[model samples]
Target: MATYSSNDFRPGLKIMFEGEPYAIESSEFVKPGKGQAFARVKMRRLLTGSRVEKTFKSTDSAEGADVVDTNLNYLYNDGEFYHFMHPESFEQFPVEEKTVSDAAKWLQDNAECIVTLWNGRPIAVQPPNFIEAEVVETDPGLKGDTAGTGGKPAKLSTGAVVKVPLFVQEGEVVKVDTRSGEYVSRVK
Candidate 1:
């Protein structure tokens, strides 16, 4: 574990507070010109999926946790668990549905993901930055629906529903921004 001052903070830095791990989601250094400078941060709790805001003195330090992440490829789902294998060691892992529930809807066989491990056990899962999935159902495009403001909803191959332009039809592959869960563009 290491200590880091709030002044040196950056997004995605994992720090420990009160024995819990929190990733810095957003940080802002504010000096009101009268009082001491402080760093106001919004953090996401790693294990509990809770978000919190904390204010820290610019000179105060927080403990950095021992978190490790490894890139792994999704193998298959056995109904109850999702399997992943490391590319280097070929070791396989099974993550419970409770852990990867949200990602399962966007998951497809052989997708690559980053598994966050805390003390060698998977604590959090990160899906790909972007993925290509085929749309399964949606209303037909209107003849004059070119504004693209209020797009139609469509179910994707991975079971996630996203808004796409009316021109996007069923059975067409489209790119999705995994982080934002927004449809990017048609694949082909």
Candidate 2:
């Protein structure tokens, strides 16, 4: 197994800590006048999506995790698991609900998504940055309200509710930013 020293700590770096795979979220180097330099790392456990903070000396090292990210097309959810297919090989697999997590809201049939695998098992799922979904329910647009100044909550076909501009109405397709859950624009 490969090892990562403190110098290699950075956001997105995956390593094994306490027998679990963790992805580094942030790393800060602290140098005090009284003692040796150390690094403070904030990482998320890939298997359970839990966050943890650890301090390491400058010379400390950790084993690298056998993590791989693959692009897969999302099929659908069967209430118990979410199905995905490999684009090239057409091999299909089912991922647990916990592994899909919040990304489940953005999943659409045949949409591309990144699946993180640890030792050949799915650990996490990342939906695309932008998703175009139809507004299934929302207040009717008022007359002369095309200025888009105020916003109202709109429920999407995928079950995610986001604030859309005043001019938006039900049944209109709108693009949303998955990272922040913000409405981008109406799909033409």
Candidate 3:
């Protein structure tokens, strides 16, 4: 295994600690008048999404994590797990619900995503920033209501509910910002 010294600590650097993989969220170097320099690091565990902080001496080193990011297409879900397939390699894997909860709202069949792998198994998934979904159900918009003034909750085809302007109606396709789960605009 490869090792990275405190000098190499930085955001986005992946390392192995306590037998698990972690991504360095942030690292700061601190030097005192009479003490040895150290690096304070905040890292998030790849499998559980938990964060921890630790201080390491300037000469301390950590093993590099065997992590990789791969592009995959969303396949069908069977309740327990969400399946994905690599476009070129045709590799398929099942991701647990807890690992995908954050991105579940934006998931659509055949959608493209980036899957983070640790030791060749999935640890996290990232969906596209924006998605276009059709409204499946929502109350009727008042005749005179405009798109700017007010909004109502609408159910989408993907089963995620989002607030849409009053003018949006059932069966209409709208663009949504996946990061915020907010309505962007009506799809033309």
Error of 1 at 177 (Å): 0.9
Model 2 lDDT tens row, 59-78: 99999999999999999899
TM-score of each: 0.90, 0.95, 0.86
List the candidate 2 regions with Cα displacement exceeding 4 Å.
144-149
**Which parts of model 1 have CA positions greater than 4 angstroms off?**
142-150
Per lDDT, what order, best first?
2, 3, 1
Model-by-model lDDT, in order?
0.89, 0.94, 0.92
Candidate 2, residue 65: how far the Cα is off, in Å: 0.7
Give the number of the best model, judged by lDDT: 2
- Model 1, 1-188: lDDT tens per residue? 88999997789999998788889989999999798999999999988678999999988999997899899999999998899999989999888888886888877888899988888877788899899999998899979767747688999999899999888888999999988899999997
**After superposition on all CA atoms, how large is the RMSD of candidate 2?**
1.8
**Per-residue lDDT of candidate 3, residues 48-152 (tens digit):** 998999999999999999999888999988999999999999989899999897898889999999899987889999898899999999999988776565999
